[model samples]
Target: MPFILTRITRDGLSRLMAKYVVGQIVCHERGWMDTHMKQIKKDCIGWHTFHSFRSLDQLTVGVMGLGKIGLTTAKVLKGFGCRVHGLVRTPRSHSSVEPFVDQLWHGREGLADFLKDCDYLVNLMPSTPLTHGLLGDEVLTGASRRPVIVNVGRGDIITEADLLKALEQGWIFAAVLDCYEKEPIPEDSFLWTHPRVVMTPHNSYNNNEDYKRHHIQTEFIVNFENFLAGQPLTGEVDWQTGY
Candidate 1:
């Protein structure tokens, strides 16, 4: 699996970034901790309504790419009693995640339906020619529940302009993006101070402890040894599919 940057949308010039790995180092559920605290801080010592905070049990989470990492995220959401739906290229009876997802959708045809009633939509889709600019005004505006958009996937999959438009029009509740169509996202970008958006510097795939754990290095060495022995590698990349 690899992460790639195809073309710069706003800047018209060509710039690229690449990564080769099957797993992500980011476990942003930790960042959700800070988000919750920030929300509380914003509320201040104001009078509290009994229903000010919605319980996790009342929410439904939709994951856009139900691969290995997505499945792991679904498990966490399930633990919160959320009804989790996953969007996959194909819904398989034998998929390890089938048991975790309450519903499944396939391809672009299934995207609108998947966003229909979700309280939160998590994007984990890989970048490819087919997926570039996939989540734009039409898709966000179609979301019936006005769900919060959380993007930890490739940035080019969604456009910042469309996202801003969607937010301004109340097409979506808010957005939390760990990556962007252009990164080291331009300092002048309004997203830096946008009330409806939370931006992080493309660090979703980084963790200080990851290296200490030998998580990636160990896996690479083992796979290399397997290759030397003519055994199966941990992952395979199909240039056409781009996964």
Candidate 2:
């Protein structure tokens, strides 16, 4: 980390400083901590290990949706040291997370298991008719503990009420949400006011920008190279599933 040169909002010096630093500068608004007391509180807790925190040690991390981010997150957790469990509609659909997860559960039955005690349970599904409010009272109220409740998928999957109940009931230790049911989230929404909640503007792929950009560029480069070489293009598309 390097020194930060901050200025009053009216000075416009921040923008001037930004031009000079380019990617090196990371700016934050003033009174950021006041806006992030829950995180401040959650971080205040000392780090613990599985052996020490028996419950934490046997962390049964659950992923509600094994989509791109969810699958990748499960993989990372497994590699960094954690037991993973995944839930999806079809057992055969998600082979990417298979090796990382200790177990896989499907359908309502499998989804029910996600409510059980776990160190972390992250929802990385989407916001479709079938997924709306999916994490209602049944799953939210049933969880053994909050399990560090995190929702990176769509916000509406779990209603605001359910989230409140989970916290009030001690279903989980903390809440970290990147996306919410309402984009930009209502200024007065409880998601911000909740004592256990941590909110972000959906930056899960922050570190993947270069990889993403390269892939797009590669797609174009590959096709152009193939044309020059007189070779067939190599890309599959399943319009039916929209993948």
Using TM-score, give the best candidate's number: 1
What are the per-residue Cα lDDT tens digits for candidate 2 across 1-243? 332121122212222221221111111112233435545567444322111223222456787776545565666566645678888755654465678777777867667675675666677665666677777775765666556766766788888887787778777666777777778888889887776676777654333556545554566576668767977655433243322
Clash pairs, model 2 backbone = 50-57, 145-171, 146-171, 146-172, 155-180, 155-181
Q: Give per-residue lDDT, candidate 2, residue 84.
A: 81
Error of 1 at 204 (Å): 3.1
lDDT of each: 0.68, 0.59
The per-prediction tally of clashing pairs is 0, 6
Query: Clash pairs of candidate 1?
Result: none
Summarize candidate 1's per-residue lDDT along 1-243 as a digit string, tens digits.
Answer: 554212212110100111201111122222443455557788544323233345666878888887666776776667767789888766565366767788888888888888889878878888888789878757778788888777888888778888888888888888878788997788888789887687767665555665425655666667778778988666565667787
How well does candidate 2 match the true structure in TM-score terms?
0.64
Per-residue error for 71 in candidate 2, Å, reads 2.9
Candidate 1 local distance difference test against the native = 0.68
TM-score of each: 0.77, 0.64
